[model samples]
Target: MGAWVTRALRNFNVENRAERELSKMKPLSAPRHPSTKSLLQEQMSRHPEIEGEIARKDDKLLSLLRDVYVNSKDPVSLKVKDAGVLQESKEFRLPIGHHFEMMNIKSIPKGKISIVEALTLLNNHKLYPETWTAKKIAEEYQLELKDVNSLLKYFVTYEVKVFPAKDKKALQPK
Candidate 1:
């Protein structure tokens, strides 16, 4: 019995040592993908307006991508207020696919958090913070306002209380 326990402890130590050694090595990125700097440059070229927006919000967008997106297994979304104007801008259109060799991404992936999920994340008080607005979530995640509005309306109809009663009723289903 004592030999078995000793062997188990030795195995655990070996595993821990292997993990530490692996941690010391540089992390591997997605295969066939451009480096972080190049990817940001490509994204900037695709969305010219986005050039200063990310930097203005979080200095040096590269760090944001590396620290937030690259390391994350799941998608990362932002929730800045007043993002509709940016999305509605003419610069945010689909890229011209006629003359591109490795830039097939027409639209960025936006993370979706259900109304129930959002509500669960927020305080139950009637006076929810302004940051919890659907518009803010849509902006942060680069989602369409119409889609977000429709989702909010649908959830509200189902009697989910993410927003104030008056606000919920006021939200157009379009």
Candidate 2:
């Protein structure tokens, strides 16, 4: 009986140790790729000429963001004008002030998006207008007009529809 009990205890200990070892060996969830540094390295490798371009673009973007946050009036306020809201409307119906979701603007993937590209998308897409002209928008939101203008221009030039309806006289051919 003593021999049998000792053997059973030894077996149990071995089984538990094996289980712990296997647990440690179990595959971990695929590790997320470290994207940022790798992307910079890839860019430098494949397109060395673009390093300067990347830096310039980054400067402009940073400046614009800074201006919008620093110089605008409301800085953090969010609002919409009725006509402007129409700019983001689709032929189908959308809630009065929820159009910005059309282009997934909040999550634009990191890449070289031109102003025309952004404007075309935001204008033609089902965006909910959250900003007026930069000056007005800046005043209301406390963002700098330069930054807001850059962002707005990107949307305005490409997606003319995203712009608020021009007043009748303003619409007259200049």
Candidate 3:
């Protein structure tokens, strides 16, 4: 029994030692090729005339770019004085007031409502569904009736619930 136990432990130690050595060994990397920058330098050295041609093309390109920059500096007028007057209509006006004065007044795209308006509409629909129906909300916010119906059906405000502890002793602070 002693001989058998010693032989088993010796085999286990040899196997463990081999595994430890294998784990410590690093993987070998593949051979590398010459870098692109070095290859480009060698090619440029062989063609001396190509260097002169490149310089000439670069100078021509710089001149063209300078001409464009000078021309762009002169502001092109949109002739706002000659343009047609903007029609004042309810359709053009925003349903909500602006937080700040806008420089340019542009009409909002059709079938869109602000985040604040959407929340208010949802809250109203939730509290007073009969008064603030999908039809009323659609007319008030200038949204499609189908879209308003979908919003009310799918979206909901956060609902919080609190549960009391089963044991009165557990509620007491340590």
lDDT of 1 at 171: 71
TM-score of each: 0.21, 0.17, 0.37
lDDT (Cα, tens digit) per residue for candidate 2, span 34-141: 877687687689988886775565667788887774544753334556556765562332222345556545422222333434454345333545444446544543
- The local lDDT score (0 to 100) that residue 23 gets in candidate 2 is 79
Model 2 clashes, total count = 21
The per-candidate count of clashes, in order, stands at 1, 21, 0
* Tens digit of per-residue lDDT, candidate 1, span 44-155: 8999988567557655766767777444464333434336556665444342223334555555324554343345423321246366576765665456778766655654
Worst 10 residues of 2 by lDDT: 90-99
**For this target, which candidate reaches the highest TM-score against the unseen true structure?**
3
Candidate 2 stretches with Cα past 4 Å from truth are: 1-131, 157-174
Each candidate's root-mean-square deviation in Å?
A: 28.1, 27.1, 19.5
Q: What ranking emerges by lDDT with the best candidate at the front?
A: 3, 1, 2
Candidate whose lDDT is highest:
3
Candidate 2 at residue 82, lDDT? Answer: 56
Question: Between candidates 2 and 3, which one is better according to TM-score?
Answer: 3
- Give the higher-lDDT candidate: 1 or 2: 1
- Model 3 residue runs over 4 Å out of place are 1-110, 169-174
